[model samples]
Target chain A: LAKTTQPISMDSYEGQEVNITCSHNNIATNDYITWYQQFPSQGPRFIIQGYKTKVTNEVASLFIPADRKSSTLSLPRVSLSDTAVYYCLVGEDTGGFKTIFGAGTRLFVKA
Target chain B: DVKVTQSSRYLVKRTGEKVFLECVQDMDHENMFWYRQDPGLGLRLIYFSYDVKMKEKGDIPEGYSVSREKKERFSLILESASTNQTSMYLCASSLYLEGGETQYFGPGTRLLVL
Candidate 1:
């Protein structure tokens, strides 16, 4: 499993864009970057995933550089409801479906 | 929508008592997992099952055991509940995908052992 590093916390106001970057220097060739959003007292929810370049979805966009060693999760026009912890995971079929999640980036969306 | 439902949202148990956390998924996914989340530890996997009656130990499985009697149901058992075992437990299910499996999680069970 590739170890990931992200910001401990980030502050953002409404209508502003929030981009959280994750670093996985040991990323493997078969690895895919995935982002999950977790609200207070709730399980993490899938936000966006990408292998390389950029992938956009209804909720957010994932920007992966050519090197694939890092990825960014961009949330447009954030709101207070978007305040949550975001986790970045990297792997694919890690023997016996073992997945690892690191301490996530806590995004605090202000009014 | 993929839905994973846990038996309880909040549970209080006494020390030395047996505890069971049940999780059921409606998607019929082949893989089901149990994870415990703490203040700074993030999410640590306890156990996972890829098929019925087959189980695998995760990173932290010392105090936890799991049983997957059927495809949609997976249960985590705590032989003797302790105060240190108090934490939020999350259940998830996913299908094995070539790109990456997207895990659907439940609301989580908050366990308080006193």
Candidate 2:
């Protein structure tokens, strides 16, 4: 299992773009970068995932450099409802299994 | 859409009492996991199962035991509940190891041990 590091908290205004970065210096070759968004009292929801380069989805985009040691989760046009904790994980895509969730980045979207 | 259902949404138990937390996945996933979420500590894995009756200890398995008698259900047991054991219990299900599918999580069970 690979350990991950992310910001403890962040603040963004409505309609602004927000990007949260995660570092996994000890990342393994078979590992993939996946991001999840969790609201209060709700289970974390899958946002985006990437092996390398960029992977985009309907909710967010994941940008991973060639180094694969770090990745960024970009949320476009943030809304008040977007205020939540975002988790970055590095693990083998075994059914998204065997993942370690770090402290995660808490994003506060203000109107 | 994958549906992972937990037996209870909230539970309150007393110390030294036996407790059971049940989780079921309708997707027929072969892998199920139990995790606990705390304030300062992130999510810590308590246990996981690859197949029916096959279980593995996770990062923080102390005082926690799991059972998987059927393919779609996994249950976490606390032999004797303690105050520190009170936390948000999460259950997740994933496809077999070879499939590399994403794990789907249930709504979670909030356990408050008095």
Candidate 3:
């Protein structure tokens, strides 16, 4: 498991595009960047994942630079409901079965 | 949708009492995990079970033990609950993927040890 660094908290206005960045200085070559979202008492929910460049999804977009040292999670047209802690996890293929989460970035979408 | 069911949504236990947290996943995922969440500390894995009767210790397992009698059911045991053990416990299930795969989580079990 690689240690990740993300903002403790971020505030954004509704309908704004929110991008949260995570830095993994010692990211391994085999590691993949995965982000998860969680509400107050719920488990973190998977948002988007990427290995390099950019990967877009219906709910969010994951931007990973070529170096792969850092990644950003982009949520388009955020709403109040999008307020949650966003976690960035870096893990290798554990025979295809496990990913761990660190303290995620707390995202607050204001109206 | 994959449903990861945790037996208790909220639990209040006395110090030195034994506590058991049960999680069941309908998806029949190959892996099941238990994590505890705190205010400043993010999520910490306590234990994980990969197969029936197989278990592994995670980052924080000092006061925890886990059992996987069946693939779909994983249980966390607190031999003696303490005030420090009071926190929200989360259950998750996932299938292996080539890269890091997504993990689906349950609502959570809020345990209060007094």
Work out candidate 2's RMSD over C-alphas. 1.7
Error of 2 at B65 (Å): 0.4
How would you encode candidate 2's per-residue C-alpha lDDT over B12-97 as one tens digit per residue? 99999999999999988888999899986778889999989999998999999999999999999999999999999999997544
Best model per lDDT: 1
Pairs with steric clashes in candidate 3 = A96-B96, A96-B97
Which whole-number lDDT from 0 to 100 does residue B22 have in model 3? 95
Per-candidate DockQ vs. reference: 0.73, 0.53, 0.69
Candidate 1: regions farther than 4 A off = A93-95
lDDT of each: 0.92, 0.88, 0.89
State which docking tier applies to candidate 1: medium
Off by over 4 Å in 2: A93-97, B96-100
What lDDT tens digits, residue by residue, belong to model 3 across residues B4-82? 9999999999999999999999987988999999998999999988889988888899999999998899999999999
Chain B vs. true chain B: TM-score per candidate: 0.97, 0.95, 0.96
- TM-score for all models, in order of appearance: 0.97, 0.96, 0.96
- In model 1, how large is the Cα lDDT of residue A29? 88
- Per-residue lDDT for A41 in model 3? 81
Q: Could you give the fnat of all candidates in order? A: 0.78, 0.50, 0.74
What is candidate 1's CA lDDT for residue B18? 95
Fnat for candidate 3 (0 to 1): 0.74
